[model samples]
Target: MKQKENITLSVKNVSKLYGDGCAYCAETDAVLDKNVCPECRTVHACRDVSFDLHSGEILGIVGESGSGKSTLMKMLYFDQEASRGSYHISDYDTSQSNVFGLSSQAKRQIRNEILGMVYQNPVYGLEMDFSSMSNIAEKLIAAGSRNVGEMTGTGDHFLDKVNIPLNRKFDPPINFSGGMQQRVQIAKALSNYPPVLLLDEVTTGLDLSVQADVLELIKEIQREMGISMVVVSHDLAIIRMLCDRTMVMLNGEVIEAGITDQILEDPQHAYTQQLVYSIL
Candidate 1:
């Protein structure tokens, strides 16, 4: 028998609601208008979203705008607190504790040492006014690196891996193009070599050529570094290129999930079928 793959990250019943939910929202018999509770107008950004990311796996979350995919990504990165959920990283405390329940300090440590995030908007992930090298150094410093030489070396290594020219490393991200800014964000996210990487629409606004290059870079990183990644993108083409398995989210709920090829070839959900066919 084949040995079971280790689960790098696990989440159970994760939810993020923007308003106080009403009893109707909790009733299985009640109808919801999209992801909103009509009775309370509570925006259920993510309702019971859960998944397991295996070692060295690239899992994709795909959905249209406002489908809660970004919200789920934010919750995974601890950028947005989950209202209810149990999140555990196998490499952290043997996955015995729900990270969401940890103290702010502990969560910060986890963010620095275990989880790395690249947001859809570069503004959320990069310090535009800071030099590209300084942005990377900031992450290293947070992860407990105290030696300037070591930090500088690490920053150079990652920036180079992402194809950012050494000569421009000292320049601020504000001086770079959108694609270059995203590359700097990627370097910063990988500076500490976190075991799990969360990417939320990282290629959203880039030109087609740039998007392809970014996606290729992500694949190279995963292959060489063995970093398990959770990639969120609405574009099915991007998912097809980067993900091994995929989950389709609609109205804040995962409507279907399975191996990426299976979903592309035989999407079961109506929304998912529409999504897959639209790209053809």
Candidate 2:
């Protein structure tokens, strides 16, 4: 990617393990198949994962199912806790403090004001039966927005930005098609004007045409908003299209990461080579 810009988000030695880890599992050199330790029977969903997100850039985490890419996104969004890790965002606590150590309230504030997330499933990000505008308002309200008129205006602005018709702003998302629902989710996520956005398989399961539209919307949003993004997907094609840099995860570990084009053209790790070649 272009010259390194200011670091917007940084993660260090992040891990998530299930089961009580024994000495064998604790060994840094422990051998595990598919992230499961044979000796201790513990599952390491993510082990010592690390990465950085630069301002105005999109970082993609690509891996197959059970590769722990989604688990990493969950930890960053606080949907799940990291067993061990340090998360620092430039907009939070001067970017020096580890967010994992913060109180629940502080984390909520960070989620509301500093970071926005778009889940692959709109159900997780939207209130299906609530007005689309209400969904956006909910996030604004969580960020301490009290002025109803202003919140509504912000809601309208983002809805329009995402191509959600203003006329349907009061309609429940349940009444919309899948692509439209995803659009609403995108609108709600960006309504906060967050410095960072996390997208987990945002185009998964959409029709090919619809997928292209959503992908275009995302790129346009990043270009116009200048928001840093971390996008997680299992598809190499999606990663190639959307990311400035790419990280390939396997068996709960990042085996390769670098400029998207470089990784695509010249992947170093065997697993990464397989992924790149499969897409070609």
| True-structure Cα RMSD, model 1 | 1.4
Please give the lDDT score for candidate 1.
Answer: 0.92
> What does candidate 2's lDDT look like per residue over 138-226, in tens digits?
99999999999999999999999989889989999999989999999999999989999999999999999999999999999999999
Superposition TM-score, candidate 2 onto the true structure:
0.97
lDDT value, residue 78 of candidate 1 = 81
Best by lDDT: 2
Candidate models: Cα lDDT each:
0.92, 0.93
In candidate 2, which residue pairs get closer than 3 Å at backbone N, Cα or C atoms, i.e. clash? none
Alpha carbon deviation, residue 238, candidate 1 (Å): 0.4
